[model samples]
Target: MSKVVMYVSGFCPYCAMAEKLLRARGVAEIEKIRIDLQPEQRAEMMQRTGQRTVPQIYIGQTHVGGYDDLSKLDRQGELAKLLEDL
Candidate 1:
């Protein structure tokens, strides 16, 4: 599986959901960047993703957007392909 990184806040429900889904998809580890703890990372997250939202996820180097986008990819059967290690 590919590396999973998520930019998240402490109280974000979507972040938890995204993580749960990722775990279900065989992602053993998720590198969670807690923007709630590191405020400066919020600016970095927005700068990189162009969205000021919790749970900005990345599968390896590919930006996977938020929980909805991740769920969509899973629903469409693309997430599995994306998670496959090269």
Candidate 2:
């Protein structure tokens, strides 16, 4: 399985949902970077993804965007492929 990293805040519903979905898809571990706790990480996330949003996800080195984008990938049957690409 590929490494999954998510930039999230404490009170983000979409972050929780994204975690749940990834878990359901057999992702055993998610490396969650809590931007709420470390404010500097938010800047890093924005620099890395070029967006200011919670739940900026990455599957391996590929930026997966947010929960909606993740769901779209799953719905299109490409998420499994991405996850297996490690």
Candidate 3:
């Protein structure tokens, strides 16, 4: 629905989980930035999201935090609405 970007590491379980959830929610394209491969991407992610987490997710211009936060929004049934806005 929107442009999805995530900062991920190869071995991050949360990254995997977040990716699964997004796919389940009908996100077709995800721009994944591997912070482990590109260390400078971590700096860019931190500066953009103000977090150093493995799965820093952005839906359009909205910072959706990490896996847990994404789950919370999904559970609350707010994620679809957010995606619609995107």
Highest-TM-score candidate: 2
Say which prediction, candidate 1 or candidate 3, comes out ahead on lDDT.
Answer: 1
**On residues 1-86, what C-alpha lDDT tens digit does candidate 1 reach at each position?**
33898999999999999999999988888999999999999999999999999899999889999999999999999999999852
In the range 1-86, model 3's lDDT, one tens digit per residue, is 33998899999999999999999999889999999999999999889888988898988888999999999999999899877776
State in Å the error of residue 43, model 1: 0.7
Between candidates 2 and 3, the one scoring higher on TM-score is: 2
**Which ranges in model 2 have alpha carbons more than 4 Å from their true place?**
none
Q: Is 2 or 3 the stronger prediction by lDDT?
A: 2
By TM-score, how accurate is candidate 3?
A: 0.94
Q: lDDT (0-100) at residue 53 of candidate 3?
A: 81
Per lDDT, what order, best first?
A: 2, 1, 3
TM-score of every candidate relative to the true structure: 0.95, 0.96, 0.94
TM-score, model 2 to reference: 0.96
Question: How does each model score on lDDT?
Answer: 0.92, 0.95, 0.90
Best-performing candidate as measured by lDDT: 2
- Give candidate 3 regions above 4 Å deviation: none
lDDT of 2: 0.95
Q: On a 0 to 100 scale, what is the lDDT of residue 77 in model 3? A: 96
